[model samples]
Target chain A: MIEFKDVNFSVDNKIILENIDLTITTNEFVAIIGPNGAGKSTLIKILLNLIPNYTGQVFIEGKLNSEWLKTERIGYLPQKEEYDTKFPATVMDIALMGIAANKGVFARFNKQDKLKAMETLDKVGIKQFNNAQIGSLSGGEWQRLMLARALLTGSRYLILDEPEASIDKSGVNSFFDLLSELHKQGKTIITISHDLHMLNKYCTFLVCLNKTLHCHTETEMLTADHIKNTFGEALKLIEKDY
Target chain B: MLSYAFLIHALLGALLSGISLAILSPFVTLKKIAYMGEALSHIAFAGIALALLLSLNLSLVTMLFVLAVAGLIGFVSRFFQTEETNVITIFLSVAMALGIILISAKKDYSFDLASYLFGNVLLINKTDIYSLIVLSVVNISFITLLFKELFYMTYNMTVAEVFGIRVKTVYYLFLFLLAINIVVAVKIAGVILVTAQLVLPASIAFQYVRKLKPAIIISILVALVASLIGFYISWQFNLPTGAVIVLVEFMLYLLSLIINKRSKVRN
Candidate 1:
């Protein structure tokens, strides 16, 4: 579980997130939605302790986020990075990085670690490409490989930033399906995404943000009004019978 | 040629430098910090200049000076959210200007600054060889043990931090190692020509290899081969060792590019 209490983050005195307060409980799939420059990624960065200058309290599992990070594991997929295509790493090598915390800085990857990486790759449907160069992967395959990396450490919580950016439409369905499975297995998921409809469908809770907390409620409660308030524009929500 | 003790020293120095520089190359190139290497080398010049000015041990004083500057560079770039290349560029200019001013301030400047600028491999002594060997061993071991962390951090620092990698410590350690290697290497390759030693082999290795493990191995091998060939060429033609080695490395990189391109075409 994570909690943000009266968090205010600024850059050059321009407030990024103002008086923000929110809570994410265990096993909850929460999607944070907002327009560009809406502090969505900033919130995640604060939770990860990447931006430590924020003036507020952030707790994970009843302790400060930094303290929690020191003791606990949180699987993370960064926003789509612009990596060198010739970076000289196989898919398996990239996936193995997920378990780096468990292995520590000096310990070599054991046979068990390799087996786990392979298994995780299989879960993401990328086992066959395990030895292939990561740069050679298609965008969809790359996202899946990153997913495998995030899952390799057996983390209890998953934090993904723009998880769907690199994934194709078809792959997005399977990706969400995998996430849904993980949620059913009781892993808390926190993701930042722009696809409101998709997030509403899979995410149990929705947090609309726009330099402030516009709405923090169940997915069903995220009406068009909340979207208008958070994004500064209104759009019709598609009705679907599930 | 091998019978000459000075030539042997040069050879050993080149071999050791090749390995250490090559090993550090991937982290430099992959992190896109080639400019940092350039800046640090220029900063090494200032250290050398100050050492000359104060009549201190060249290697020791330069190592200490570079270590401090490198630490500052890493801290400023990380904590201040500034562009690292820009920080390095500023340091490069300031250090170069300061080095020149320091050198000029001393009226009785007996040291041949050109030797440190363009390298005099034949001047490498027993102590320099020993230092190179020790630094190479320590740096290679450090990188090997922390290879995964370095690779992950190079790819994504935020994700690496979130995974509890102690990125700051690792990052600072890396900068320190880089400083040590640059100081050790400045004797053989000189400040101006050293970045080639830290960049070319790794870039060449990446052109052919698909994994960091093999890439590093191949890079070391490439460096060794280039150093040997360059040393031989310099011996036969009486050329500058640093420039010849860098030229050889550049040729190797170009060759790798062609080879990789041709293979892609064949595929």
Candidate 2:
């Protein structure tokens, strides 16, 4: 569960998010949607406590976001950047980072951490690639690896930023299907995305955002008007048979 | 050679510097901060020149001076929100200019700039060895303790920050270790050629491996072999120790490149 109380974030005298207030309940799959520069990522960043300059408070399950982060209660997958393709890291090495907080800064990974990482990789369907170079993986495989890392934290709430942006169209359905499966297993998932169709089909709750909160309700309540209001234009929202 | 005290000290300094550089290299390469060595060494050169001019304890003065410069580099890069390479370039130019001015202004003590620029094993002493030991211990401890944190930072800074890892503090700590290593290495490789020790072995290891742990182990082995072979070659030919070691490492890197290419073609 999460709550944003009257949060206002600004930069250099320009308001990026203004008077934002929302609540996310437990075991709810939330998809935050907006256009470019619409403060979707900024909202996610605030939730992760990456930027602490906001005017209001963000509480995660009755605790402050900062405290939650300190306890490693939340897991995140940020938007992919142009990471070094030739970086000398194996799949296991990257996956082990999920347990870094639990192990602390000074301690080495114990047998349990390695086993959990391996199990999570198996859950993501890429356990066979555990020894493969991370740079050699396909986009879908890499995203799955990152998902494995997120799941490895043993956190109830998994927050992802644009997990589908880099994924191919054919891969998007399977990816959301995975998230749906995880949600059925009672994991609270909050994700930011530009893809409205996937958000409508897979996500239980939709929070339309645009520098300010526009709507937060069931996915069925997100109409074309909400889309126009949030994105400042009319865009096609594909209707899929559920 | 065994009877000479200076040779023994020089050998000890070389071994320690080689080990430290082997550890620092992979991080530097991964972080894309290789220019740090060049910038910090230039600043240390200025520190050395000032120490010679004032007839002070060269090691103490140089360490303090380079530490201050390292702090400034960290501060400027963080505070001004500028690219680290840009800040390093500015500091490099200023430090080199000041070193030249300081060395030229006081020409009485016969401060052989060439020996400092290249290196002279005979010049190493007990004080340099002591600094190397202390700095090496600190560096090893820092790397060992903060191994996971550093590895996470290298993989992705955002993930590290989100996990409450104190990315800034880790970065500053790394810069501190780097500054200390540069100071410890000066007695063995001199300012101009020292960064080769930090860069070449890691580069060679990266050419042959795709895993961080293996790459690190390979880097240390490469550095050890090069230092040992180069030490003997320099001793036999009466050549500069630092230059010979760097040359040997560079040649190994070239050989790795060829080996990698041939393997790729065969595959």
Error of 1 at A45 (Å): 1.9
Backbone clashes in model 1, listed as residue pairs: none
Query: What range of 10 consecutive residues in model 2 chain B has the weakest lDDT sum?
Result: B159-168
The top-ranked prediction according to DockQ is: 1
What's the residue-level lDDT of B174 in candidate 1?
89
Highest lDDT: which candidate?
1
- Which 10 consecutive positions of candidate 2 chain A have the poorest summed lDDT? A233-242
| Model 1 lDDT at residue A131 | 87
Return the clash pairs for model 2, or none: none
The value of fnat for model 2 is 0.58
Report per-candidate DockQ. Answer: 0.64, 0.58
Model 2 whole-model lDDT (C-alpha atoms): 0.84
Model 1 residue A99 CA deviation (Å) reads: 0.8
Report the CAPRI category for model 2.
Answer: medium
